[model samples]
Target chain A: MALSPDDVARLARLARIDLSQAELEHLAPQLDVILESVAEVSKVAADDVKPTSHAIEIANVFREDEVRPSFTAQQALSGAPVKESGRFRVPQILQEDE
Target chain B: MSGLVLQTAADLAGLIAAGEVSAHEVVAAHFERIAQVEPQVQAFLALDEERALAAADRVDAKLAAGEKLGPLAGVPLGLKDIFTYQGLPCTVGSRILEGWHPPYDATVVKRLLDADLIIVGKVNMDEFAMGSSTESSAYKVTHNPWNLDYIPGGSSGGSAAALAAFEVALSVGTDTGGSIRQPAAVNSLVGVKPTYGSNSRFGVVAMASSLDVPGPFGRTVLDAALLHEAISGYDPMDSTSLNLPIPPVAQAARSGEIKGYRIGVVKELGGEGYAPGVLQRFNESLALLESAGAEIAEISCPHFTYALGAYYLIMPSEVSSNLARFDAMRYGIRVGDDGKRSAEEVMNLTRGAGFGAEVKRRVIIGTYALSAGYYDAYYGSALKVRTLIQQDFDAAFAKVDVLVSPTSPTTAWKIGERLDDPLAMYKADLCTIPANLAGICAASIPVGLSSENGLPVGFQIMAPAMADDRLYRVGAALERGVADAFGGPVLNQLIGSPAWDALSAQAVAARFPNIILGLAENLS
Candidate 1:
């Protein structure tokens, strides 16, 4: 339950959010306290108690592969920040020099 | 026609259907009222005048053709910004998705149009429904209609405020850990969180997917129930959406008979940290229910106390996962992608620049909780605790038909009072999170002004999943039982009537002083 700033920074990197040093300092303690408080769950979380991933029971919804009405390609690309040739455009995934 | 803005959805729908008032006029009246009070309330993120009037025209056309109208037809409704509505900026109160326009409608949005309700505008909320106060919004903070100085409880703050200010007759909001009910509690509006899967979430932006369920808000119990019925039905698009018949909520609301129905007072949700005035109003509401022929008893749900801890763990864990979609490649704003940084680096920078502090805090916590080595201790145990909480509800429901509690621990605080203290703010939903954990239905109906601060207090009611109508049934009876003493629901008198204009912010507290009895005495 004790979350250090370094621990938070590592998690932030994993979560794909680049947190500044200032945010790490400020939020780490807040998150640490939150964790310590939530850690109280360990007191009653006996192994006998089954875990509930969802409150309401639902099964994997299967459907036929039939085509249904959906967003047109034009509509699909409408909200894209960068697009070309009817596809989303992104920054370099691989460095050419490398 | 001039008093159209003040009329309930039921009244407006009746008038529109009976040809007493044109649907266009009704929509116009609400828009005009929005123009007047919106500056002070700051409830809306965007106003769609063109879309609203067009929808109104369609309703009018149906009437002209002598075709049957949909239920709640032509009534203006405020929508929470999280729901996708094509052609409007759906911010979800976050800067990351600022100016993002969804190309399609959420299933709930489509259903609202099908029901012939006019969508006035998108209302503000806590950024992605994370915070207790509306102050966390990237846009303006929504003020409570009862007192402009205090925070209207959030993350459904603006949805509650818009209706409470009478800008719209009905509004829609989603509750993930009491967003709808808490705001409804402080604003003196009726809000419902229908049973999980009872309503469709196909187009609602995901926030803690397991817990988030879109719901309805109104000035009265019946109005909320009527809106509830219109929006709730099975949709194949949502795997969790129950393929079952809609509960007869409006019918139950109309029948104010809870004779011999057993109600339980939740032992965990009250006392200790609860505000004295909030408890006073809750106790008074219990007396009303008792007099209305409902049997009441104290029911112990011991695991309920740990609901807040489990919710913070579960909700943010889901937030971290669900929000991973905003990678800046597909849609929304992309920052620092100036052809130099790699895609991963750009995604990190864009998210950092785009998200607010609260959003970052939650995502990081979610990441940490779901991370290996910590998953069993944090996330897994929270899941186990969730099972215990549901079991607690199951045992309680066996002895009682429904349970009651104060919707929120305290009335609305000042705008910035608890913002810095995240844990302090999280406690606002203390009494309401248990129902979400159990996936059961819950509602908050206006009781009266808290004696200490004079802010509105709401009485919380809970029913087993799929039995949502019971919340309406008991809420109606209690509302009727207490109606005469306060001259009506205090909310109806202060905001839902034409005379409300004179009771604006400062005037209301100075004029009424005591709860509604003082106003009733003055009116007499």
Candidate 2:
């Protein structure tokens, strides 16, 4: 259950939050303690026990898709920091690698 | 009309029904109160005078037309910003979704509207309901009304503080771990977190979907129960919402009989690590309840010792999954990345810039928990722990009709005391976490003030799932006993009636310098 520095670094990368050197150093030990604390939960839980996912037992509640009046195209772009031609404009994705 | 701020929603309704006061007059009085105290308290995030007045007019119109209105007709309510409304922004206190208006009202909001409750405004919260203190709020930290320098327990701090400050009669707040109860404890307000699925979560901005529940906040136990009764019950739009009929919570509150009830004081909670003053007040509350003809005894639930640890795991893991939808493409705020950069890069830049430090910490921990090679070691095992905790409550409830504990381990601490230490912040939730882990109903009632600091302490009451009414009955009786001994609800005696002039311009200037300057400039 021990998490290495590399594992911590990988998690930071996966979560997309840029961590400082101090944060990486601090988190390594804190996360280790947290893992150790939670590891105890694994002991008493049986293989026969069903995992509780939701506080209440629930299931799929889907609605049929239908055309409905929505915020105007202009209104949708109102809050954006950058926009163009009724669509959200972002940094380009295509490159020579393709 | 003299103490309408302290009157329960039921009493207010009766007054309105008898023509003692018009809905318009009530709304206007509350608005004047908000104008006075809101500057120092920062209880509301958004307030539309037009909407509140319009809603009041509609209620007055109904009465004039000779039509009977619903139970909470014209009663003003403050909504936690996390709950979605049709036009109002529901940010979850995260900049990533800033200014994003929901397409429709959350099911709980819709239910409140159906009951004719007036929405006074939206309240501030911890960013995406991530922290135990309101200091983690991105916009501004909410201060405890008891001591202006101390923190109001959060992420429902604004809702609790609103009740304490008398800015609103009632509010709806969501609790994932101890958001509602902890704040209520610190602010000396009555707050309830009903059994999971008792209220619908259809359009609430998700934090940890499995753990999140919407509940009521009020100045009195019966007020909270009446609000809870109006907003709870089945909603076809919410799959997780219980179809079972809700018990009459207000009726239970009116019943003073607890002679046959057996209340178990959790042996695990009132132990070492609790502030001495907090424990003293809690025992006093127990004595008051005992004097009211209820039998009190000790009970043990060993699994509770590890509830906080398991809660951090399960909640953050769900948070990682739930917040994934807020990428730069589909949502509010987006940061650009180079053309060669992957989608992950764009997501990272957006999230890293948008989220606060605590939120980032949780996202990293959650992502690690759900990572490919670590799923079994983290998320999977945490779910198993949750089931065991639920079973522990189930077994404990078999021996006792209800359980009791101190709502919080300590009174509200000074603002910066634990801000630098996240572990200490997480530890504050120790006494409150078990109820959330067990999916049981819990309420926090202010029992007495601490001798050392003169701050309030709350006693926690818990009941098994779907036995929320039992909590109301016990809590109401306890509230009456404690209040009678203290001469009043303590909160009201000190804060006094809400007034437009007492919340001085100097206090407002000191607390919200920039906001006042902006308002003055706008006026000039």
Candidate 3:
């Protein structure tokens, strides 16, 4: 199915990426081509076939619950683009009056 | 000690062990080579000369104290930018993580260090490992050492180019789709994608969590096997890592015998759309194997045709989910973060500014595929198709001990040839994706030069999961047989080529003048 520009915009929002109008227009047709090409999967995949999430077979893996040396707060926050008081600082989440 | 950069990893290890050369000398030789050729090849994104020399010094000190060094001691390596090395940038070839230095090392990085391999630098890749060529990298474009005008297939292009240029004997690369294998194929190097879960992914930046696997590259089969042995095995840090003992691949590579082995040629991989020169080399390798007493059979994997289509759907779906962690609040570059703006706005602005066109395209496609109405039609069906592809492998392996195919459909194209067409780029991985979907081991070894372009073509050898040794044995045998036919290793043809020397002296800006300047301006 051909994706409309509105559909592309909705996807960009869902993905939390802000796409310019030109980007949405450019990507819509490419996404449509990719989507149509990949639609071939529907032709051969049988109903009984089990979908594979992880290619390898491993069950819930457990490690010892013993405490070990972990990254210090400073090290953990080193790469943060915005940090304050040993925490990741972000733009305000809630509005002033809300 | 002269020409030390040209030695194989195994040979260098032997030299280091026997006290013929110090690890420091080996590391210095590689750094010299890098300084010479890196300008032309554009293989490295970042180089920590002090850190690499310090690491090499430690190895020399250990040897002086009479302590036995690791198996691959003194071999210089190029670490792909995706794998984190503490205090070094882990950009994963995207502007989103441009100067983000990780606090910890990737499991593979630590393992390679413990084995005493001096890491020369972090190499370039396609942005977030998204594209077939390194053209999508937000940084410099990596040129194929053989010819500057053509690409070194990616997203492991830098790693492959490093080996081809003799800048490093070994390098680490991740194969989410054909990243490792395809680059190695075009560059005339050896690349391995171990069975899924065989290598830990603790700190390698995830492109597709289910498909991302860190592997090794070398100019020779045994060299790749040695590096593979150093980096692979189960890691508790990675939940999906297999807990079984790593296969004895180094020994198998040394043995180089595949006598009486059953080799199956996949009917789907190499007929239509395959370049003539690629097919010729592939058939010659098959004939060589048959003459060596191996049984060759034509096997049909009908579902293989759909593997590429399935991969595009599933890989992007996982890419979208995996890449969501790069919000503006933490890590790397943030944009439009005025105090008055909301966190959501800042995130959207940062993502919009940071991610490249290819990355944005995949993310949108993935979001649409996983959206409410399209999940079953796209992502769900892709998963089912993965099962069908795996089943095809199971049926094929039941008849043959291993499978063989062309690593890629053709030789490397000119740098800008496929930039406008994403679908054409995706088709480059068609021959290599089925093995990833099946969770098996596959390696690409240089077959011969393409008669058409005089560029290298790789012959892929695949073995069942946990049967990785079989791939090495067959690959080594083919390498030995083909080396004898060609007078020496296939890469030997590239050693003194005037084209390589001329390309090495030319600046990358000269090749893509306007585009690179535009990228530089954007980054600034």
Q: Isolated chain A: TM-score per model?
A: 0.90, 0.79, 0.93
Stretches of candidate 2 above 4 Å error?
A1-7, A20-33, A46-49, A59-94, B1-3, B337-343, B496-524
Q: Model 1 off-target regions past 4 Å? A: B493-524
When 1 and 2 are scored with lDDT, the better candidate is: 1
What lDDT does candidate 2 reach at residue B37? 68
Error of 1 at B345 (Å): 1.0
Candidate 3 on B354-466: residue-level lDDT in tens? 99999998988888789898899889999999998888999999999999999999999999999979999998999999999888999999988999999999999989999
Residue lDDT tens for model 2, B1-524: 13676576777777777778888777777777676667677777777567777988999888889989887898888889899886577777777777666666788888888888888788888899888788777777776777767788888988887777766778989998989999999988888999888888888888887778899998788889889998888776666777788877888888856886899998889778999999998888888888988999899887787687778889889888888777777556666555656666777777877788778778778898888877886778778778887888888899989999999899989888988677788877888888887778899988878997878888899998899998899998898998899887767654543332344333332222211101101100
Best by DockQ: 3
User: Looking at candidate 2, what is the lDDT of residue A78?
Assistant: 59
Residue A32 in model 3: lDDT = 88
lDDT of model number 1: 0.88
lDDT of 1 by residue, A30-76 (tens): 99998888888878899999999897988888889898998899999
lDDT of 2 by residue, A19-61 (tens): 6677777777777776676667667667887788776666776
DockQ of 1: 0.85
- Looking at candidate 1 chain B, the ten consecutive residues that score lowest on lDDT are B515-524
Residue B294 alpha-carbon offset, candidate 3, angstroms:
0.6
- DockQ of model 3 vs. true complex: 0.86
In order of lDDT, best first, we have: 3, 1, 2
> For each candidate, what TM-score against the reference?
0.95, 0.91, 0.96
